[model samples]
Target: MKFDPNSNLVYSTDTGRISPSQVEKVIPEGDGIIRIHKESKGRKGKGVSVIKGLALDEKNLKTLAQKLKKQCGCGGTVKDFNIEIQTDNRELLKSLLEKLNYTVKLAGG
Candidate 1:
């Protein structure tokens, strides 16, 4: 038989029980401050507002992203615990987030 490095024995008689590898969800931690910034590096000069430092679960983050997008009348998405709104209006986003009682700050130049 050929050796397969990618395959692992799930169980063996001598070992009795073998557990498979577990995948863990990564949660982002912040300093209780929400930051909004503009980025246009890879999107062919199309700017996007990136909101970070939100200490919420994935579901809540999505919900918040939806609300913000709706209120801003724009499109956005939640990725890696950050919200990416397809707009360059950081001030509007900052005000909206502040109205929701989140400590907001404008980051980057």
Candidate 2:
């Protein structure tokens, strides 16, 4: 039999095997600060720009993500209180956030 690596995931021994969790939501404090960074790991050397530390709730955050994605002309999403644009768009994102009145900071060198 072919061993399936993903066939054995358990939430708990008593609870038996379970699927992954997707409803995990992060609520960010509205501190009016934002951070942008570039990440390439686990993406086949393709760098993605991540914008985090935004002070917005889920609804507004999603709206903002859509706007940024549209402006960047790329796909993106809001996850774990962070906004991830599919490509390295740090400079553009920073300008956008600044225009939105967010105190933007570039993260990492």
Candidate 3:
């Protein structure tokens, strides 16, 4: 509980690190499976279509999100390995993804 400047020791190992541990880049698996769903709980009943389980790197994911947003004529964003489109158009997204050769699944009540 006392500061010891003379001691050659570190009080905290992660004082100024961005990430606690190194995150290895993921290699996307074959014909990655993508799951889409509609979520409205946190958005005050304005449901947004959430796409998950896409085995793509960050760059590719971002590009895909942009394309999908344009095709759907809506706005969207990519975050934490998932894409969220600002609409409840699951079928349109599913078909678009399938055309890109990715296996797609719909989830949520």
Candidate 4:
């Protein structure tokens, strides 16, 4: 495929021009849920609930938390493998995370 320098469309060598298709693909095996955690005093200090079963060093949780804070107009931070928002807005968090391709659940902490 090749595109003109100033244009946003592209062309294929064999197909000539390609038309954009609005196809939606369904993804499986994405049923993992995010758990909302409560703050606790651990050996280090105050710890909070965050999404579980994710990579130990990944920053997706932090990014999700930050985005939610902005959307909810609340203050929050990401730490200890989780994102802690200032408000206990579970429903809002769920919807927001789902939009970001996460399955969410309350951990009951």
Backbone clash count, each prediction separately = 0, 0, 0, 2
Any runs in candidate 2 off by more than 4 Å, and if so which?
A: 1-26
- Model 4 lDDT tens row, 53-76: 434243555666667889989877
Error of 2 at 39 (Å): 0.6
Q: Between which residue pairs do clashes occur in model 3?
A: none
Q: Report every candidate's CA lDDT.
A: 0.90, 0.82, 0.85, 0.61
Q: Please tell me which model should have the higher lDDT, number 2 or number 3.
A: 3
Summarize candidate 1's per-residue lDDT along 56-85 as a digit string, tens digits: 998999999999999999999998899999
Q: What is candidate 3's CA lDDT for residue 7?
A: 51
Local error of candidate 3 at residue 51 (angstroms) = 0.7
TM-score of 3: 0.74
Predicted model with the maximum TM-score: 1
Clashes of 1: 0
Candidate 1 at 91: error in angstroms? 0.9
What tens-digit string does per-residue lDDT give for candidate 3 at 1-109?
8976875453346664344244456655645568898898988888899999887888989999999999999999987788999988899999999999888999895
Candidates, ranked, TM-score: 1, 3, 2, 4
TM-score of each: 0.79, 0.72, 0.74, 0.52
Candidate 1: lDDT of 45?
93
